[model samples]
Target: MAVIGAAVDSETKQVFDAIARSRSVTTSRLAGALITDFIRAEKGGQVVTTKAPGLPAMGHAAAHAGAKTEQVYVRLEPYYYDELGRLAAQRRWYRSAYLANLLYAHVDRLPVLCHDEVNAVRQVARQLADIGRNVNQIARKVNIDPDRADLSAFDFELVRMLLDVETAAVKDLVHANLRTWGATDVQ
Candidate 1:
């Protein structure tokens, strides 16, 4: 390989360095464009801004190798960290691999909920929990002594109606929240 030295401003150097690192564009092409721009400007003409040439076709492995990845740091509680370690061990994977998989599983294809949507969801969840508790209490009463309690079919119907109303309210609120947040297509 032949090397050529040229003086350029720091900003220009940064642009050239970025192009070279991309691996899709050559520094020689970038240098040619810069020189063209300089010639036009020297002639008292407007600076010509042209798009970079297309990249050469690359093999699958070359493309994969050229792709960039970044490292991310996260702080976790000790208990959570230990649990993650245990899960990784159970799966016979590195901690990073297990954690990445867990995150993808939980978040993949999920809609981005805003603060208001999240709060609405939490409220609906609390209401559902309350309804569940009430149903459980009714069940316990019936199961403990069915003969003593005069719980007729009407009582069960009333409970069912209450559940239906709560379920409908929760569904409507969630739908409205998602709509307001501009997430209409989410499942």
Candidate 2:
């Protein structure tokens, strides 16, 4: 394994660190996956573009709270070093950020959502939560005062069925989103 030392800007390093922390993996491991994916894409003749406008930016606190730059040393096979150099040169991107862009492009398990899609998902989630709360409240009231709660006209089975259907739909939507983002084992 040859050590490839690269200087990454503070923001990019912070972003990588944040993602690594979230995924409970080391930065080096994440970098290795990114490099592997990049190489595979290149070899398959896929145009690997670095642009990801949908990714959320690192928080303001994180952006301002690190060294201006940092050194990342990854131990890779010798051939990867040459390939990385060639690809970075071809793309005219800094070596460290080139790898960072690959990471951004292929975040595992994170569904990349456009701004409008995010808003739409949030709205649906909020509505689902509200419905859940209402159901729980009604159930609590009925349990506390069965006679006064007026369950004579309410169909508990129907409500349960509807909730089940919505739950399945939400799960399907989540699995579809994960699959769309190249994630597997969507359970």
Q: Report the number of the highest-TM-score candidate.
A: 2
Steric clash count of candidate 2 = 0
The runs of at least 3 residues in candidate 1 whose Cα sits more than 4 Å from the true structure, single-residue gaps closed, are 1-111, 181-187
Give lDDT per model, in order.
Answer: 0.60, 0.61
- Model 1: lDDT to the true structure: 0.60
lDDT of 2 by residue, 1-187 (tens): 8555569999999988876554445677656656765887878955322222222233212323353434568887889988888766755666675565455435534454434446667876786788789788889998999888887777778778777876776666667655644555765
Cα lDDT of candidate 2 equals 0.61
Residue 145 lDDT in model 2?
Answer: 93
TM-score of each: 0.34, 0.40
Candidate 1, 1-187: lDDT as tens digits: 5555799999998866765545455677656666777898999977643433333222211233465555668789999989878867764667776655444333222233445546777877787788789878878987999887565643767767877887787677656544433445545
Evaluate model 1: give its TM-score.
0.34
List candidate 2 stretches off by more than 4 Å: 1-107, 185-187
